[model samples]
Target: MEFGTTSRTSGKPGPRRERSPGGSDYAVLSRQVQEAGLLRRRPVRGVVLLVVTAAMLAGSWWLFVAVGDSWWQLAVALPMAFAFTQCGFRGHEAGHRQTFHSKRLNNAAGLVFGNLFVGLGFGWWMNKHNRHHAHPNQVGRDPDIESGALVFDGDDAPGRTGAGAFVTRHQAGLFFPMLLLEGWNLHVASVRALRSRHTGAPAPAAVEALLLLVHAAAYFGALALVLSPLKALVFVLVQQGLFGLYLGASFAPNHKGMEMLSRDERLDFLRSQVLTSRNVRGGPATDFLLGGLNHQIEHHLFPSMPTSALPRAKPLVRAHCGDLGLPYTETGLIDSYRQALGHLHAAGAPLRAGG
Candidate 1:
């Protein structure tokens, strides 16, 4: 949804004020959030969530193993995928050091939940995510907006030839289906990153690589034991496809279609985050489904703040943005997706024309 970018006083537009690109706006907001105690870690909440997610994972696996019918196993895959996504979210929180005060503990959790269980590379994800957070929608710098199957901007659109031209012409319509492959894409990317010298710490990356191997072995071995080869293949496709779709659906709305900053743009932290981030409008159900990511604006503003506390920080952040005449975009989930798709279609226009 659109939000005003002009100052309001007494229900009327005030004199326009220009903010310096690198002003102290973010610093002031950070101090306010810190003084209000929103930055404190919530270990108990983190522990409870961890325990509950583990139990759910165990239960789903048990159901998958115990059920003989392919249909029942397929049904079980739904919860299994959901549980896996939740574990991935936990890993995300740990990666941000929001789940634990101790860096070592957080790293341990990130490795276990992200690398071993979810098949994501913790170190690789951390480095990439940090860059995204540092430059949310920056054209050249933000890896999230970098050239991919679905280009985010016309300038980054693919060459007008072969699959690139075909996909760019239909990216908006193909976006959701493409997301079905995201799980596999992420797995390959993680493996490549771990193997690359640029990822740092060869020994640790090797250990993570081994753990991923173990996870794959256990995952396929369990499925093979429970079902025929064909069924096992189907199960893998269903589970991973759902996992990727859920992940992409939940994350795409956070920033897509809002704003695209130039590579050399110098924006204050507050303006950069609020303008780029879009919040999803919902309550508890949204929180559970999105892993409290519905409050994208707040999360972007305070990356280390616990997810549990994001909802509480939302109104405060919204009000502050309103007072400062900053953009605070929030929209329903379906509308957000539509906006994202629309943005993609518009971005691909130049490529389609060139072809």
Candidate 2:
């Protein structure tokens, strides 16, 4: 698969990852990032983001109502779906505590953006995402890499039979198509998590449940009111399908093709973040579309950094990685997808070959 300019650490292994005596190398880089003021919180950006999202939601709803029971409501669903994913991105930032200084405020923002806006559980996503960040690409520890519907690790690719084998063998071809259902899957997972007594929801289960119910009511109730049953059904399919596809596509490029660390693979914090994640090269449009996730390496290293600040932090992080002789992967958007899909195809090769 094609990639942009990468260091010695890209296709080839770089220096061995041994912790330096006295302290971790991450400390040195962390100090530089912090001193550059990249760690500072900027609430104005958060406020502006919230306002714009709210306006988009409001405008879309108005258009839905204005259309007044027509096939065109499906058109309205397009922007609405995009708006929902934007809300999801904001909730993700809140979960990382990147939007606010106070933990309570961040949690509150997460609830509003997640359960209230996107109908996803903030707590459930936070729990899942935090694990991913802590152990990105780790086969067992990172939930993102754990095999289920799709087998990510080669170790889990063999011995499949029947449907599982067929799916595993064709997973690369099916990946993007499968993402069309991811929106529904996320909703189901959230509801299931909220129902369990041991749900890791940060808010009271009652509160989370209530907000989800409200969102569902408002969302479907409005759709039902404005469109015929068939039209509403079509609209829901279009909106949710596009939502899932958009969200999945935005996230898939970050680390899918990168190295998957085994439990025994030891890496310092800096290396772990840089080595596993990838960056996407583009202009401001890329930043907006990915919600600043295109800068995956910088975001993973300094998750608390504001999204707007990721561009500013990129050069510093890249320079430091260069100094440390670490791999810093950056690719065009299309090429990133190619790398990820190529990895999936390669992982599934054994199944295709009669294993």
Per-model TM against the reference: 0.92, 0.94
Per-residue CA lDDT of model 2 for 49-85, tens digit only, reads 9889878878888999999899988888889888988
Clash number by candidate, in order = 0, 0
TM-score, cand. 1 vs. native:
0.92
Q: Model 1 clash pairs?
A: none
Put down candidate 1 lDDT per residue, 117-136, tens digits, no spaces: 88878888888888999999
Each candidate's lDDT (Cα)?
0.82, 0.86
**Model 2: ten consecutive residues of lowest lDDT:** 1-10
Best by TM-score: 2
Candidate 2 ranges with C-alpha deviation above 4 Å: 1-15, 197-200
The residue pairs found clashing in candidate 2 are: none
